[model samples]
Target: MELEVKPRIYVVRLGGDNPKLSTALKLVRLGYAVRIHAKEIPPHSVVLNPFSREILKPSDSALLRRYGVVVLDTSWNSGLEDLRSMVGRRRYEQRVLPVLKAGNPINYGVLTKLSSVEAVAAALYITGFKRYSLEILSKFKWGLTFYELNKEYLERYSSTKSAEELIKVQNEILRSMGLQP
Candidate 1:
């Protein structure tokens, strides 16, 4: 009898590399299917990642087709240079601003990404507003914590545990900018 072996395949998610990839893999390695992404694409059908096109694959395109294409572009081949172009006249002012102030891109150098969004929100709240530590929100399962929704934050926005919840979170984020908790 003859035997054949196939090389194991791994998918390195698009966008920025995820540090927790290994940790996540460890939890469900056997008899499990996993999806990992480097950056988060907004609610869109198509994404254009001019930078690091290598990350895009046939499967990526297929997966993206599910959404309505909230994000038209994914990354810049020269990401930093692209960022530089985006800043332009504001270049000097940008350096002085913190990562959070720079805007909410899923891939912001070492800044917080979608995986870290929930805890980052907590950190932002703790450090910038309540002047406390974010020991609580850190334990949340998602990028945003459902229990921590303060009255003020929920006032302008609504809440839910389903897909619709994303809208509320997005709304709260707009108002939460620079204000902290």
Candidate 2:
């Protein structure tokens, strides 16, 4: 394999919603040939990731196959269902889930409240995060953005979080994300 920067373009597909598809398609239209790898997706948007093998249903996969997209259902069996071998789903998961999860305590309403230094709020939430992990998602929520909630979720825990502090963190996170009350 040859070395390259941003070797492939990835699209986020969760069950049935792909908010970034339009953005990605727009990029494609601008002359960027990108490779798409999605998880779950909604109907009507099948035409977006026409070449992805990592899709939701066998039937949908077949339809996408016609468009050149491959379908590999991660639910039919146990164990890690990885698309990296074919398209690289791991990269997308690694890139988006952490931040999104960390920011989960915060919300759309809380986002607006974020202080001038967004990093401070983010750091406050992710502090002591020597390690972390992410939650399994069935679909992508637009509120989380491309990085998910806070990006801090991508690591394993080195220390445990306190219930009180966690509550405070959660509240702060939500407030920062713009979730009022």
Best by lDDT: 2
- The residue ranges of model 2 lying beyond 4 angstroms of the native Cα positions read 1-4, 12-21, 33-96, 100-181
What is the C-alpha lDDT profile of model 2 across 44-109, one tens digit per residue?
232222124332221222232222221222211221234233333332211100122322223342
Score each candidate by Cα lDDT.
0.27, 0.28
TM-score of each: 0.23, 0.22
Global CA lDDT of candidate 1, please? 0.27
- How far is each candidate from the true structure, as Cα RMSD in Å? 15.3, 15.4
- Candidate 1, 78-119: lDDT as tens digits: 234543332323211111111122122333222222222232
lDDT score at residue 138, model 1, on the 0-100 scale: 38
